[model samples]
Target: MTKRRGERPPVPEALPVPVVDAHTHLDACGAQTPEQVREILDRANAAGVDRVITVADDLASARWAAQAATWDERVFAAVALHPTRTSTFTDADRAELTALAARPRVVAIGETGLDYYWDYSPPAAQHDAFRWHIELSKLSGKTLMIHDRDAHDDVLKVLDEEGAPSTVVFHCFSGDLDFARACVERGFVLSFAGAVTFRNAGALREAAAWVPADHLLVETDAPFLTPHPFRGRPNEPYCANYTLRDIATLRDVDVADLASTVTRNAERVFNLGDVVQSQ
Candidate 1:
């Protein structure tokens, strides 16, 4: 007798991996459990996304991100109080964050920086927290993942004044070509996200074209900023392909080469050599 459909052999996995998503929010994207995270990462892997940096902006989400990273080989965590969430930061919170930053799975000190858009937290609080995270990065010797929104000048000023860490990444880079040139000159990495794929993102594309190969990276920033063709849909780590393809087109290079180069840049910045093994 013929075997039941349920007993059919499993299909082999797809090949030809895409670029790594240097920044994502798998934990904040409603993938709280191991099973949920596995499903997200599996989808990403199927889409040729070899790895992801799961960033958390608050204490609870930071803990969850760390746990997810520890449990999954594909997920690396970046823990810090995001600019919007700095309202609740306390001395105890700083101590806890310091301890968490020392953890093996925690690779960076952000999703932190300036955001004058929402002002969910006061500007002063955000600045104070940003400085605190900068110090934390210096102490831990980890990379700094910055999140600047409508506050580029101030962000740059603070970073320069605080003597930014050697490895600085501007996640979801929203600056112009001039800003990008300055960042390149300063040896800072600029990570493009889904927003770069939007039709109205000519300025972002121009910046992408100008970013040095060694300082270019990509991210999904999932559950938000989904790329074109999926712009309005809920984003996930798997959608990183669109950003990578768009960036490659802007840089006038083969997609594979761009992907490989950005992946190497990310690994270098986040110290993910041990995690991005197969990529």
Candidate 2:
């Protein structure tokens, strides 16, 4: 059966254990009001995606993401000016983001790496913003969530030049096997998105399969890369379950075991011990 391009994929069976969607964009997923955010989280929770980190691409979305984290116990936020939106980066913007990074529930400063694929932001501005974000992550003692797209070398170079934060994650990791190994070597986490499930993404699957359990994570990158067989459809956090199962299959690991491992990894990566205990 061919699913319509505009359709939303049906939720897959619930996982044997809960896991976290390491990165997603609630605002981009059409979640505006508190009710909408709750509904999204409720749907994700039902599928064993108990927690999600809604990432921001700009100051507006950053504010919304930080605020949305408070709407539900299951939701957390990552704030930053995305690489593509950093063309006009300013000190005022940095100050605001610095303040947001200190929020208790804003667990990461990110989605702020290099993106050579998009011409929206100049390379120079992106590098400057990425460096500042690295410092902010260190200062705030939060995980640094990165958004690397077709700029792997430059991304690595900048992080090296700036000295990456203690906890750095490559959101929607688009790197190949060597890049994956490089990231693992640096103690940075690699988060796979739905794109890893695509039939044409053999290299990505290889990278996903090879990454160590402790350094691995999963995300939907929703409203963007809906997984295979549902490509072009609308995506939400619940879709992460499908991506997780596929990754487990790729790694030849039991789904439940992989779920447990990734859940634990996410908890530690985001410092969600208190949140998990509260639940």
TM-score of each: 0.92, 0.97
Q: Native-vs-model 1 lDDT?
A: 0.85
C-alpha lDDT (0 to 100) for residue 209 of candidate 2: 92
lDDT values, one for every candidate: 0.85, 0.91
Residue 183 in model 2: lDDT? 91
Clashes in model 1: which pairs?
A: 18-48
Candidate 2 residues 28-77, lDDT tens each?
A: 99999999999988889888898999999999999999999988888999
Error of 1 at 98 (Å): 0.4
Best candidate (score: lDDT): 2
By TM-score, who's the top model here? Answer: 2
Report the Cα RMSD per candidate: 6.5, 1.6
The CA lDDT at 74 in model 2 is 85
